[model samples]
Target: MTVPATAAGRWASLWGLAIVPLLLLGAVLAYLVATGGGLKTLQGPPVEQLKVSRVTLPERGVIQVHLVNDGPQTVTVPQVMVDDAFWSFTAQPAGPIPRLGRATLTIPYPWVDGEAHKVALLTSLGTVFEAEIPVATLTPQPGRDLFVRFGLVGLYVGVVPVVLGMLWFPWMRRLSARAMNFILALTVGLLVYLAVGTYLDAQEFAAALPAFWQGTPAVLLIALLTLGVLLALGGKRQPEEAPLGLSYRIATGIGLHNLGEGLAIGAAFALGEAALGTFLILGFTLHNITEGLGIVAPVVRQKPRFIQFALLALIAGGPAILGTWLGGFAFNPVLATIFLAVGVGAIVQVVWEVGRLVARNTAALGAPLVGWSTLGGFTVGVALMYFTAFFVKF
Candidate 1:
């Protein structure tokens, strides 16, 4: 039986309308799962067991200790004690240590001269594992500002989308293509910088592994890269575009990306790496704004109702809250790299489409306007880099 063209079109429309809400609901569910069923107690590992390897007071002001987990299961070392003295500790919970996977714990030491101290790991299970080690306190030499600066870099990168949105409104829709292209180029620059500057540096820190695990850094990097590619490329079936401006597929993808970015920020902060946390927060914040624009840009093209535009923004932003909470617990450089790469790919696709639009609209705006707008976009990116550098310093 041949259905009328009108009937076919209506059916397609109805299916498209039904899909968005379903996808949104799924996104919420996935977020809940990632965050451990939304239960506070279940947020961390059931048990945290560790074998203390070494402790060093690299500087008189602050002491740093590195722990190696030789445990069977995942553990969270919530606090550490030295000689029965309370010291602030930042536990990096990398989950399940896989029978021998190592994790590091950094703690601050306030007392300059204390008799040889005993270190203890206070787990959620209320169990204490203690190891006594001698402390050598030396004059504090400032570590390079690179650690803090990289975080700021993330922050500035995050502000771009919000700035652009505020400056360029509905009337500026005509300029969207050129603006997006500029944003894409800027994002590429930042990502490349982060990939080399931040990711490589972290790898270097991990490279000082014991002889038994000297090759772990390289092996882990490769494994993470492969996993990232697979996850980004291998996913569910595609969906039809909706009249409201986005398809279920794209919205869900963006939502997931935002959520992940939020987690990166939250986890960084939770680990007591304040500089890194600030940077990630700023970077993701700006990144989310751009994503919001991406969601609404196409819908704006369709001249949708204001209510629809607002709904789209909420969908993109909603996932960020989930991401922030999840990030507080999990911090994996390889995983972060994968998410960064996926974002780069999506931004590239958007830039290509925008370029086509710009080419088509050249006649509408003279060459000078296009040139100026592009330059303006690039400047915004540069400014972000500078701001990040300034704020994230040791």
Candidate 2:
């Protein structure tokens, strides 16, 4: 028997609907891939072991050193040697190296003279990686200082996507469910990736804590596991009809999670951990964009009022400000870990919900597109993580 025109039309419509979001996702992925998957080049190991390749002194009193890392593992150099005199150096963390990576160290010097200087990377093992480089004799030039501060502020605001999502969700809602689902899947992947990544960072921080505070990890792990089980129970009880509602809950949980992420970033930067701060920022920025998508996914089922959508976005994002402040100023590792674990637990609960949604939606949409979207989403998260690790000076 031949299918009716109405049925055929409906099927065609469904297919058309699915294509749009997939296309948008493809475009975003393409952009990410083109930009080296948004990865930053890793800053090489400290200058302690290696010699300076070159040195230039700015007229205004800034010193720049080009250095190489020939170490087995990435190392951080908190100080550098100049003319047999050691100067406080801020070097980002170097990374997993099968063999080699290079990093440049920049320092501010008010005095100008052609000085023969030695650079060194001091390791915890009490060994020094040392190199000698020459600083050019240069005069100082007057320059404005506020540019750095202003530039940072602009960068911070630009990375935030929630405002844009709130503004656009009304229009985005006209798209089909398949399209929305694809976006939602991508969002889910991003969150899972971030949650895992942040949790690992928290563990690292815990490990780095003073030996006297070391017992906190075991206690935190147990508490987090217990919380995860309880949150999973709540997720299990969610009604199926309100799938979008479930998305809202997940987004809310993720928003809280992002707060912890902000705290990590702020604390790292405040503590003078430049390398760690850089990595955390890059990772969190990429993660935040997908998070913006998550906030919009549930409400996309029915085109929400712009104000309502924006409100949701704000609600989801509001915690970040508080988290950042707490992390930067409070500098409490234990508290940060607790929040990190809580966020991780909540996200784990949401991931289960997303998996169920994907399974149910695939039957109607066909496995091909859903599979592609799922893979694409996963790749996006993984690539972002790698890129964050690669570049962010960490």
Error of 1 at 191 (Å): 9.0
lDDT for each residue of candidate 1 in 60-110, tens digit (9 for 90 to 100)? 555555566555555566667776876876655543344455666666766
Give the number of the best model, judged by TM-score.
2
* TM-score for candidate 2, residues paired by index: 0.52
Off by over 4 Å in 1: 1-168, 171-261, 273-300, 306-308, 330-337, 363-394
lDDT of 1: 0.49
* Candidate 2: worst-modelled 10 consecutive residues by lDDT: 139-148
Pairs of residues clashing in candidate 1 = 48-75, 151-279, 154-283, 155-282, 155-283, 158-283, 158-286, 263-323, 263-327, 267-327
* lDDT (CA) per prediction: 0.49, 0.58
Tens-place lDDT per residue, model 2, 92-204, is 33432122454666666554454455556555545676554333444222224423432342235222655554455666578776766676666667667766765675676
What's the distance in Å from true for residue 49, model 2? 31
